[model samples]
Target: MPNAVSLAPAVSAQSVAPAFHEPLHTAHDDDAWWRSSVIYQVYPRSFRDLNGDGQGDLAGITAELHQLADLSIDAIWMSPFYTSPQRDGGYDVADYCDVDPMFGTLDDFDKLTARASELGIKVIVDLVPNHCSSEHPLFKAALTAGPGSDERAMFIFRDGTGPDGSNPPNNWQSHFGGSAWTRTLNDDGTPGQWYLHLFDSSQPDFNWDNPAVHAEFERILRFWLDRNVTGFRVDVAHALVKADGLPDWGGRPDGCSSDGYPGHAAPMFGQKEIHDIYRRWRSVLAEYDGDRILCAEASIDPLSRLVNWVRHDQMHQAFNFAYLHHPWNAAELRGIITDSLQAFDSVNAPTTWVLSNHDVTRHATRLGENNPEVGLDRARAASLAMLALPGGVYLYQGEELGLPDHLDIPDEQRQDPTFIRTGGERVGRDGSRVPLPWRADEPHYGFGSTSGGWLPQPEDWYTLARDVQQTDPDSTLNLYRSALALRKQLRLGAGSLSWAADYMDTDIIAFLNNDVMVIMNMGESDAYVPSGTVIAGSHADAGAEGVLAPNRCVWIKLN
Candidate 1:
């Protein structure tokens, strides 16, 4: 093991327990904090490593609480640190109530939450109720109990087809690729029943039809709530309840027609039964004193269908994926924002905006396409525009530094199941999930004292390290800090958006939120700057001056 580096003192949960239980942000209305809160997504394994074990842990997160607090984020939505098999990056949960040994113990998580609470940052943990690690004791017990037993009934288990029962029950495909079903072995080493796993075979889907499954998840929610988590980000929120009878999707021979959604009908998702689960969860959140909330990771299409998850009785917010997946064109973005506002407004729910997360190519690389400098500029512009919108926002870790996807990860070191299952035909999400760079001169970019973290970082990241960006006034990190401060000061999240219809058809996207004018130039040529005192901009050259540069966005204070 690498020699342990000293860390800031950790505040014990016992000492802070009394104050931590109380609400931290009394400045914001308790009933509406979740509506427009700026939440930062913390992927623990890639965030920071306190121990010299090459993987980030709870202690690392606790040590960084002050950094998030300084960023002015209202809450931190942590990715899973629960007892997991490390498959799917902790999404393959083996136990719901405990932290993984790799991440640290229960007390360590308690300390992390306690520190976060003290910093006025609410903790919202990831909750994967749709499935569990196959190695979980419950799953293992189901296997040992054989078919038709009470334990086996808790998970979706169906017999295979063909003469010797070799094929999967349905034609559904795994998100990671190949068949969605994995057959189990009997006592005699013969093929037994097949279990459904939408993502990977190691993560078996739960049978929500079973009341025992409901009871278990309810208990899991209470367990985390009792530990003082503000809320949950429900994983694959649209996928808990599969269509009745598990019908073949859209009569397609291979059943892989529409990627994640499967078919036009989407038999595997958007099922009506899923709402009842959220309704019950909403009630559970209501039992808590804080404005406990649920944010859905439902990848449902068409803003209309997506709005259902955020009805008053369900989730507080669902990710506005239409905005995330839209092209960087001004017209496309304008259309998506308009649609998102209208659709979400019908349900009286806030539209959550996110530019990049752990699952996709970072916006810096994605928007720039081929040019690195251009990508960084566009990313900054996008951040400014996203923050100006009227709703909650999620800032993926390292996004503030304008980090691009580390596209050069060696094939041998790749761990994502999507990469392995696809035989490297597709690069998968590993590029975007690389460990963050904290310091330029330190070992492993200061991720850990000993190593460069679980995944390799690009050498170019030295200049982009968090410390490097913090010192530079014009750096993307400082840009985010400035924008977040202004966002809070102006209460932009609580405001409403109004389009500058005169520029609607042009390549410029101009809008007003709470009397602050926001404009972006997506045209081929530089556009004449609008009449206003330029307050904040995506580029250093942006000021009360000549023209707004192409691929840049600006926030103006109109007199």
Candidate 2:
């Protein structure tokens, strides 16, 4: 039957893709591997423990590379494990070259890289460039120099008497709360200048305007590439460049001061100059051997701006946060997916999808808090929706096990800087950072030997233990394996595909790619699709008619 729909032929054995063989610098090779890559994020603090220190380290992660390999993940995007004062849980990096003591030494990191390579899993580390800890040597030098010093220019330092000394140089708010600036004592016992921090006071903003800063960052990038790091997950990538001249962000209606220090919206965070910075970074990454991935965590609203980050020459893929924050509903889910595809199509850039991360509440907790069965079912559906997409897909740790957020931490035990400064009005991130359960019947739930791990393990984690799930034929782990294998066999990432919104109405979203129709039932009731060859699904058997039960998904191949 020669119908309008036909399956695209697989890549020829002799016709090599340009990205795989060419140097990364060539336009033909940029963003080559990511198109089909499935990235698995590992939050080190909670992944595993090797030394019995109650904290996960490089050795622990290295030992578990086989586990990731068994799941068929192509790459691992690890959160920052750099040296830090633990102010922002490793986000505020003090040194880029060295591994944090708590995470083991540089040798351990190298061994982990080698082990992951052996398992065919690429390693991507989080790169924090926008800011450094207040204790960083560069910031310390600026503090001692006071005003009119060369080292002081490395940061945004303004004297108290900016015009009249009554107002800050500009209006900007810290993300945590209150002003973004903090005053320190000068060597002469006089009022010292104020330093700016977009996040917390302890994380002082870097003066990217300084050439020294640019050169240092370039060196850091090269250092990692030389060590065989597969790529980087750029942290707050859009915030790298700010307005050359600090300006007032106008007064806030919430009664909080909008003065440039913190808490107020400022235009400098996403300046146009950011593109130039990215180009320079990309140029350096080109020097590497393989197709090095660059995933940006640019928290920009307005889907159009987000698409810009993934254009031909920009980031390989920028995090799509629409699904993370959207309300769980049939219409909302359909709209987000449709809009995302349209936005990416408009820009000719591939799209990426992430349902949850360490920063946000667990998806299970968000959807299953009231009805566990429904929530788990919905979680499975969401995973299917994301995996079937055209571009890359990211799976946060414990997502496969259906782990929910654990919010039983005492107020005094809180560790997140956001919670500490906000006074508990907002839920902290501790709930999502709990240890992974390796065994259901172990005394400590197989997290570690200690009664209390780095973060408290959820009581419910025992049921979702890795050992138990490995044995269950219908477990989420097996489902992920099946989905990944199907995707690989189809080679959809390298094929030309088009989707129509008319077929994707509320409660049901259907899209066609390379002769494959992905039908998703976002509602609670069963849905039907025209008969086709079933490629993958949650059902035990695939009948001629594609009937999907509540929160079910099926990929059908049309002849």
Candidate 3:
């Protein structure tokens, strides 16, 4: 049965479906692959588990390369699998050069990278430069080295303000929650100076002002580069360089922007000094062959400010958070797409589009509101819209399967620091990071041999498994595969986009790219289907004559 929405109008005669083909994408410099590539974000712990350890690992990722290659993506960006305490989901790096025991060993990563290369897919690992795990040797040494020691200087350490030095150095709030500062115990077992942690207390922010810190990260980068990894997705890229003498932002602990920041002008992020770090990284990447890349997870706003990080000399790509966080409104999306293109064009950089990731709610749940069916339809429609944009795209794992955030995750099972820090006031990101469903009838939906992985999978996920969708043309997985195949065939990622004429006043998003016109109806009622040959669509009724349903997207080839 077609995954058609109830609101879709009855089908009449089919439109004149066209038979046409465009030349393959134009050739560019070897290092320019990232300019228009589709990179998949693999959340290691939840993707697949081959070891039956109840968590996904490197070997599991290797086992799934064939499936990823089948999707036609250019690369895979795996979230951190480094040796860590697993606090903050491996963002807290305990050892930069080794893999966590739970994930696998260094040899496992080597084999995974080699297998991925054989399938023509490049690998990009996560680099957490903004902070390190408290269990890291350096951080551990810093804690015992006292306030004024060189070991302590690697991180943000400061004297308290009160007479007895009891108060925190500043009132900055952590992204995880509560005070950003955590006091330590001196050698004599007395209350020592406070150290800063912009995220969880287990992850202490590094002081970029220290030259040794810079040298250490450079060494760590080379360690992986020598291992033949393509590049890195720099974690917390914008927050690496804080303002001189970290001042209080006066922003409340819970006051976060759509991109999860305390406003764009927060003193702790987007500091000018951050560019120097990227420039250095770019230089480091230039030393290696194969066009190694660096993608920044910078959430800086005002497209103008965010563009600076992707300047020709700095980083290859910075995520387009503005576009990701926007609602399903046609006008809003148009403005953001236009603004993003213009802003990135000014810097001679490609705008990266992403809808969901490890940190945020899945787009299906987010766009659907209370209606599961509506959300799935809109999510599919949104994917069509995002893929039509001209730039790099980062697809979070399992998004192709139309997975909703596991919103019913039990409170006791929640592990995100945000949940613990906020005392359940905010549910945190555990829902988005749940293990993926690969097989309908297998144990844990084929994630592992057990009943479930770390976080529980929704019982209803069986219907959405890849094995079930592979045979259904109208399934979300099939929709993504068809759209991706077309994207590559027509080279849409490298094509130019222009707003189609005549629909400017309507609630429909109509844009033309090369010989293809992408139309999405975001209005309350059915709208006229544009006159053309239907090529692909987000819904089964997309090829229907006369009208397009609300939250439906279709690609048409000019007659």
Candidate 4:
């Protein structure tokens, strides 16, 4: 059977065929790999540069799997490397089935996946489903076809409100930094129809209400599945479906803010109609042999609503962002962990914990004042704590190096649209996406053989580079290496967690995962630890006997 699907008449059948074999995908029971995996996110352009073109590419990623495998992570969740103008860091994909030339060719991607598979590393590529590069052939046709044509129906195009059709249809706003609508000139050189873009103007939203959109995405999925990729990390997972009537969202009068518009109950995002698409996608994955997985980047509020996307028949794992947003307080962290675990447990889905990602500030910078040393201590402690919890985990690139956000990147060098479009009021995500420092002595710290990466690296990064810390037992890099080794040895990935009554202090979080004791002191003073053999510690201060230092944590073995 081919991966052909029919549109529901809202779109014309002539636009796409209902039955045809383009490609195929299959799955296997193979360890239920997603259940207890530690997945690392690789932002392609900033990870490594193979050709020293100062741009990271597929060949660079393929060459770096040994480092990831050595770190003991089970999988890799790579950011988008598809062809695009890079208006939004590759999230605005122009092609679904091919890799961008800057990232390398399809052959490079296939070799990367094959190498990762050989290392027992599952490859989960990013899939941008909500919107696409406006340059897509379908969207180009939509612009050329004008109103009432099947091409125009492929996207969310509508007539403007004013008499001359000069005003937008509603009050929606872009998630990047401006109005969600962008007007285009007609083929005849006259002002024409408006199209909705949830983010940048170059990235236009698709009409999921249109059947052609549904069938097209299904084929896209099969195209990658045929390439032997393990799964997809869906970008903007929940905002795909629009509500009835595309009603007014009461967004800002200026039509742009740092966080963009509210999505809690907005007509454009978090609608109930989105899950049906996932359910269909889930069925398609099941058609294959392996337990092909779907993980979401949905930012819905309320643990209950967030859990809805991870129901047994929908996605397998959804990022537990609530846990990430929690401050470094013992009670707050514990409360979020309990709530998140309970919510996902109810759905029989595994909770995925993360402290840093491409979209936010690094935890080292987030948990402390303007103090890098203090921030590093808290970040190391937090990493050990998150790894011990009973769920999967996501480690962002450069975080293991204890890297902090580059707070001083020059304005001219910054590339994130969020920063450029917001008129500099917001710092945006570029600071956190700066190139990584791999060698202490090399220019750009070994991110490339010659020049600095596409994004510049700060001078201070040399001290935290991989070459400086890889051999040091007490370095943050080595600490992660040792902790993950122990995590696997203890089988802490899926287990029951309980608070240790005797080890509890006002700001101390001491929990037992299965039987191994995990302790963290988030207070201003030292806390007593119960009798047990110390296995691992975040910092040298945790080396003291039965005493865990402030902003330090340790894993203990107790039978």
lDDT of 2 by residue, 91-157 (tens): 9888899999989999999999999988999999999998998878888898887787778878888
TM-score per prediction, in order, is 0.93, 0.88, 0.94, 0.91
Per-residue lDDT, model 1, residue 312, is 96
Which residues of candidate 3, in runs, are more than 4 Å off? 1-31, 252-264
Q: Candidate 4 lDDT, tens digit per residue, 1-559? A: 1111111111112222122122111111235768778999999999988888888889988988898899999989899999888988998888888888989999999899899989999888899998999878888888878899999888898888989999987878776677889888987888888899988888899999999999999999999888877789998897888887788877542222226564465677678888999999999898887768899998876787899999988999999889887787776776787688778877777889999999999999988767888889999999999898877899999999999999999888888888887888778899889888888887788888865577888888889999899888889999999999888777777666776544333576767776677888777766666556788899886936667777899887752
RMSD of 2: 8.0
What range of 10 consecutive residues in model 1 has the weakest lDDT sum?
Answer: 17-26
lDDT of 1: 0.84
**TM-score of predicted structure 1:** 0.93
Better of 1 and 2 by TM-score: 1
Which candidate achieves the best TM-score against the true structure? 3
Per-candidate total of colliding backbone pairs: 0, 13, 0, 8
**Superposing all C-alpha atoms, what RMSD in Å does each candidate have to the true structure?**
10.7, 8.0, 4.3, 12.8
Cα displacement (angstroms), candidate 2, residue 29, comes to: 12
> Which stretches of model 1 miss by more than 4 angstroms?
1-31, 250-264
Clashes of 2: 13
Give the winner by lDDT: 2 or 3: 3
Over 4 Å off in model 2, which ranges? 1-31, 161-168, 188-190, 250-265, 495-502, 539-546
lDDT for each residue of candidate 3 in 1-559, tens digit (9 for 90 to 100): 1232233333223354422223222222334788889999999999999999899999999998899999999999999998888889999999999999999999999999999999999999999999999999998999878768999999999999989999999999888888899998888889988999999999999999999999999999999999998999999898888888777777544233444444565778888888998899899989998889999988776888889999989999999889889887777777888788888888778889999999999999999877889999999999998888778999999999999999999999999999999999989999999999999999988999976689999989999999999999889999999899899888888887777545555677777777788888876777776467789999989747857888899998766
